[model samples]
Target chain A: MQLSPSLTQLIEALRCQPGIGPKSAQRIAFHLLERDRQGGKQLGQALTKAMTVVGHCQSCRTFTEQAQCDICASTKRQDSGLLCVVESPTDVLAIEQTGQYQGVYFVLMGHLSPIDGIGPKEIGLDILENKLQQGGINEVILATNPSVEGETTAHFIAELCHKYQVNASRIAHGIPVGGELDLVDGMTLMHAFTGRRTVSQL
Target chain B: MQLSPSLTQLIEALRCQPGIGPKSAQRIAFHLLERDRQGGKQLGQALTKAMTVVGHCQSCRTFTEQAQCDICASTKRQDSGLLCVVESPTDVLAIEQTGQYQGVYFVLMGHLSPIDGIGPKEIGLDILENKLQQGGINEVILATNPSVEGETTAHFIAELCHKYQVNASRIAHGIPVGGELDLVDGMTLMHAFTGRRTVSQL
Candidate 1:
């Protein structure tokens, strides 16, 4: 059966979300029509308000409605002359969830993938360089994912940092929490064995 | 970290969509804040437009922006003597995808369930009764799922149709096409064997 043009368009637009396929989109659209008018209105308002008002913090590149995000604006956080760089705002959230990192973040939006035509300019390497030049960031933590493109991006960023006279280090690669050796991927297993620290030495 | 009241509220409001877990919701909210301004605007416009415009077709109880949805409005659809009854708009779409069924549909929106508090009135059973009384419908196909609740709903509707002197039939339950008999659940196997058709007149 033919749906209303607007309804069809709404489903099409909702398809952009990562896991929402055509069937799921239709189900969501129908559910929106059937059950939750209030939810629909709230969703609309939230989407519009957030996209219009929220922006990147000038210093840390974290999202903020002001000139700087709360972390960047606060005087209380220990600066530590360190900056932790990540791939996306989602990755920023993941790191923040750890509660271990005290430094600020610089989100690259995506890793550089030359094969996919994604380059330094596409992923905002220039922005990182500019931020580094603004001073006080002595150490850079390259926390990109442990994929090929991520590794390439990290190495490129490290070389760039060295040229700018800044110290940079790639985050450790190993088996994740609760991971068994048999279940871990080959690269991670190799990394874990190679980077193993002796308890007796410690 | 504590978010602003408005930001927190907006994030909370985005929880209505299916498959959007708390972390995913937070990530999406952050993505809208960091980038995707145009996407957010389009999403809002699409949502609000669909919600304000789409409603149930008066006759079939399916979603539509018009007084009657396309299926109900089409003179070409075989409205002759058969009506397929289904649980929701999703079911309507599922039935339509077959291209085999020529009849129009009557959407119940829900099934009969007392524990969860869904009842006949909630699903507009009386409306179906009224339509049955108006006649011209020779067969009513109960196309609800094979779940216990669906069976209960079908039985209830079938009884009502019988009271109105109308023919009612439930869709057969059996092993699905390409299903392995060894892997089939015991109950389904029993149903499949019992509902098996006679291939030879031996």
Candidate 2:
């Protein structure tokens, strides 16, 4: 059917979302036009504001409106010499939710994917290397995902940390706390076995 | 964690969409800011354009950029004297997709709900009444949904048609095509039994 030009434009624009398809885009467009015009206007204003105002934090490369992100500016966090490197800001939020980490962060925003032409510089690795060479960090934590690209990025950063004589560690991998052994995948089970520590060590 | 003010505002604005809660809103907001800034900007422009340009079609109350909707303005439809009354613009799209109905539509956009303070005038029932009284329409098809409010609106419109000396008809309610009898609800089964017609009559 020939939808109005404005309606069609709205639906097409909605498809930019991660999981939204044509049908979902149409549904969202119609919903906004029909039932929530005020909400739609608010969303438009917010999108414009975010696009114009939000930018990468100067210190950590995470999204922020100011020069540095809250974590980078805060004085409350302990161990300023410890740094946790993550793939994205969302990962930063996830780790912060745990409240166990007392260090700072370096947000890569993406891992190394050579086939997609996403290299070290694309994910701000050069800036990370500069930070490592500047020599304040005592330890570097690689908290990237267990995927192949994440592994490559983590190893690359580990090499940089070694050159800087900083301690580098990867987060442990294992079956989740409530997960059953039978449900655990073979790769994870093998990693668990190989990474196991003695009871006395624990 | 303290998200940037603009990021938080964007997330809050995203929650206005139906079925989108806090997490989904956050996800959409981050996706726009991190991965699809161009698309986000396009969406904002689309929203602004739609809000400024789109309005109800003067004839049918369906969304259009013109005075009359395509269907209402078209001379190709077979029955100019037949009017199908539907609950929403989406319902109009659904019927058009069937390729069966050749009549023009009068989009109410909502069903009558007395408790919600939505009366006849609120859903353009008075406009429909004026159309029926003016007397070009020979058949008024009540295609509102079979819900309580839909039924009430259909009956109300039917009464108005009777007063105006016009023929009124309700769409049939029956077991859906390819649907098993066992899977059908009791109310629908009852409706099927009561509204049954012989093949010869058909």
Against the hidden reference, what TM-scores do the models get?
Answer: 0.85, 0.96
TM-score of 2: 0.96
Stretches of candidate 2 off by over 4 Å are: none
Among all windows of 10 consecutive residues in model 2 chain A, the one with the lowest summed lDDT is A72-81
Q: Give candidate 2's error at residue B19 in angstroms.
A: 2.9
User: Best-fitting candidate, measured by DockQ?
Assistant: 2
Error of 2 at A91 (Å): 0.4
Per-residue lDDT over B18-90 for candidate 2, one digit per residue giving the tens place of the 0 to 100 score? 6577888888888888888888888888998897789999888999999988887887652568999999888
Off by over 4 Å in 1: A111-134, A146-165, A177-186, A189-202, B2-11, B26-35, B114-118, B193-202
Docking quality category of candidate 2 according to DockQ thresholds = medium
- Per-residue accuracy of model 1 over B130-158 as CA lDDT, tens digit each: 98999878899999988899989999999
